[model samples]
Target: MYVTSNFTWHQLAQHVGGIQLQLEEKGFVKGDVLLAITPHSSFELILVYLACIEQGVICALVPELTTLDLDKRIQTSGAKAVFLCPNTSLTLDGALEIDFALEQGLETQNYSEQNLTSLIFTSGSTGEPKLSPTACITI
Candidate 1:
């Protein structure tokens, strides 16, 4: 499924034309992992989330998270892989990088009755942050 931010779909298809075709011909069922690293655009986060739904793979999105936070999220999400931007760096136990240019495409996934997706994190208000979980699902 080549899960990525909004502007990279075209460029990703261009680079991995063979792989993309293989996926499409096989009903786009080859994808089982996702990597999202859009620092400047929230659209990237949104796109990746939708891609996860289409591909039926678990997704983990962490925005400007600290090293400790990254470790915790990765652990909890059990993400098979991670994709980060050129400028973003994260040190974790198991993470890989895939290179693709920015491109555009139309989103075709629908989520009318899906459960709310969210991550639990510390609020960091006091010396020790309190853990809170929020859901963003649609009915």
Candidate 2:
């Protein structure tokens, strides 16, 4: 169950579906990484993740930092696209952008699973930062 300041599960599912269609239509086939840079306070962040997963895309929900290291992470992620709020000035050439303005739900699906679905960067408060990728092991 997700509890946002003023959000519902239907809203989440609708947003997720729209994002899924947006990514797939942009040629985000299996095994592509989708970068998401947004504050944790944003409820749409969760929708972005769920959509990417449905499309078999790797969702790299990086932390919000104003450092060159962010560039390095985006580069390392090899993201085919990035999703965030519309008003933000975030830009990445050759990567598809999905904005909040297009949050209306769309029905689409092409699910695929890889050994890795996400790559996390920890809070530097603990340390500089670490790349801890979660690998899915199928037995």
Candidate 1, residue 39: how far the Cα is off, in Å: 3.5
Error of 2 at 4 (Å): 8.8
lDDT of 2 by residue, 1-139 (tens): 2444675778667778877877777888767887777666455676677777777777787756565866777777776766654334565455456654455665556554444567787756755555666543431
- For every model shown, the clashing-pair count is 3, 0
Alpha-carbon error at 18 in model 2, in Å? Answer: 1.4
Question: Best candidate, TM-score-wise?
Answer: 2
Give lDDT per model, in order.
0.44, 0.66
Task: List the candidates' TM-scores in order.
Answer: 0.45, 0.67
Positional deviation of 126 in candidate 1, in angstroms? 8.1
Between which residue pairs do clashes occur in model 1? 7-103, 8-103, 116-137
In candidate 1, position 74 carries an lDDT of 56
Task: Mark the 10 consecutive residues where model 1 has the least summed lDDT.
Answer: 102-111
* lDDT, residue 58, model 1: 37
Q: Candidate 1, overall lDDT?
A: 0.44
